[model samples]
Target: MRCVIAGGGPAGAMLALLLARAGVEVTLLEKHADFLRDFRGDTIHPSTLRVLDEIGLAEAFHRIPHRKAYGLTLVTDTGASRLADLRGLRGGYDYIAFVPQWDFLNLLTAEAAKYPSFRLLMNAEANGLIRDGGTVRGLRYHDKDGEHELRADLTVAADGRGSTLRVAAGLAPVEMGAPMDVVWFRMPREDGDPGETFLRVSTGRLLVAINRETYWQLGYVIPKGGAERLRAAGIEELRHHVGRLLPFLAERVTLLGSFDDVSVLTVALNRLRRWYRPGFLCIGDAAHAMSPVFGVGINLAVQDAVATANLVLKHGPSAVAAVQRRRMFPTVVTQFAQRVAQKRLIAPALEGSLRLTRVPELARIPVINRLTRTFIGNGVRPEHVASR
Candidate 1:
């Protein structure tokens, strides 16, 4: 069977590698010339590690430089608490590995290059779907040279949240609404700095800091459509806010010299009511755009790729609906949890109500903490790599 996958993000690149390993002919197209973009999804959950181990790349994956967070730490106005103990989870790979996403993608593509059946076309952007009657048969894309067409028995859209192919195929995702957007930037980290990834919450402000060996990837959350106003207030205001919330970073917040250094990520929570057409299938963020609540988006996308490969390799394009059916439960469950957190926790905290204090209080309970860890670490119905 021949397949053409658009977008070389986590889902597209992973599915390509898996299919190529199974000796299937696959062509992967990436719009970007390189995978060196900043602040892409960097969290690699244990569930994804198990997928790598299944494909025999766990040890090699660990060789890449990364920081490990055994659990999530939460600090609020009242006190500090351990939100989830991932170390206690029942798995060989228990900790969340925070590695640069480019490293991860490069590793997958490099391994895929070993198989002659795998073809990667970088700097090629999929412009439209090639349709025969009402079914999609392939895609038309353009690289530095010119426009070109590739025909395949199956087409998969893994292009990300704002997928061009999905729109071209007339698939619209139901908007679930998000309450906040995030400003991401980097700050220096010293040797004795707090090691674990943690969230610091103060009245009317929320900050998430992820340890990145030499620096911290900081995410400052603000109410939806508030980024312009925040910029108007000046970068010094944001620096002062960060300093007031986490005193230790007071000296280094100045590293964010100007608003130019910050990048805005407008969060959205939505999913497609239908994930497939006659000859095409959509997976990953292409089908369901996830809010970055638990940092599980990448892991969920990886699972979708595994399930897609498992079914499609055996049943061909006829298995597309089965892939959607198997994945819908997890997508719905995770998105539901995100919506609840946005409504009850994050939104209230941003509104200065301090309802986020309940998170630490509830997390103190052993069973509640265990259950939270299980849901975050393993997710709902984690898929395993099936033999081709």
Candidate 2:
């Protein structure tokens, strides 16, 4: 079978690699010339590690430079608490690996290149769907040369949250309300700084610091549609806010010299009511745009790719609906958890209510911590690479 996958993000790359390894003809199109974008989802969960292990890439993947985070710590005005202890999980790959996403993608694409059936078109952007009657048969894309069209038995949209092909195919996502947006930037890490990854929450503010060895990848959360106003407050005001929340970073907050350094990620939680059409399917963020609550978006997308490959390689194009059916439950459950956290915890914290007073006590319970870890680390129904 021949397949044309739009977008070379996690889902697209993994799906293409699996199908090609199974001897299916696959062409993967990536709009970007390279995968060196800043602050892309870098959290590699255990579920993804298991997928890599199944495909025999785990050892090589471990060679890449990355930091390991065993758990998350939450600090609030009331007190501090351990959010989830991932180390206690039964899987051998319990820790979350924080590797640069480009390194991860480059590894996948490089391995995929070893297979003759896999074709990667860098800088090629999918412009529209090629339709025969009501079914999508392929796609039309243009690169540096000119417009070109490729025909395939199946078209998979893995183009990300703002997917062009999904829109071209007339698929609309239902937005489930997100209370905040994240401003991501980097700050220097001092030797004396808090070693564990943690979120510091104060009145009207929230900050998450992910250890990147030499620096801390910071996510400053603000109310939805509040980015412009925050910019108006100036960088110094923002710096002061950071200093007030996490006193240790007060000295290095100045590293964010200007607003230009900060990237705004407008958060959204939404999914398509229908994930596929007659000859086409949408997976990953193309089907369900996830809020970056647990940093599980990438893992979930990888899971989607595995499920897609497992079904498609076995049943061909007829398995499209089965892929959706298998993945929909996990998507719904994860999104529901994220929504609840946003409503009960994050939103109120941003609105200046210290609802996190119970976190400290809750963290002491062994069963509660274990359950939280399982939910965050493993997800609902992790898929394996059955195609191999």
Find the candidate with the highest lDDT and give its number.
Answer: 1
Tens-digit per-residue lDDT, 1-388, candidate 2: 8999999999999999999899889999999999999989989999999999989999999999999998888888777788778877876788999999999999899999999999999999999999999888999999999999999999999999999999999999999999999999988888988888888887788988998889889999999999999999899988999888888888888888999999999998999999999889999999999999999999999999999999988888878899999999999999999999899878998898745555564546899988888888889998877866
TM-score of 2: 0.98
- Backbone clash numbers for all candidates listed: 0, 0
TM-score of 1: 0.98
Clashing pairs in 1: none
Superposed by TM-score, candidate 1 places the C-alpha of residue 248 at a distance from the truth, in angstroms, of 0.7
* Per-residue alpha-carbon lDDT of candidate 1 for residues 1-388, written as tens digits (9 for 90 to 100): 8899999999999999999999889999999999999988989998999999999989989999988888888888777888788877877878899999999999999999999999999999999999999888999999999999999888999999999999998999999999999999999999888877898888889989998889989999999999999999999999999999888899999888999999999999999999999889999999999999999999999999999999988898789899999999999999999999899879987999876544445456899878888998999999899963
The count of backbone overlaps in candidate 1 is: 0
Lowest lDDT sum, 10 consecutive residues, model 2, at: 354-363
Give TM per candidate.
Answer: 0.98, 0.98
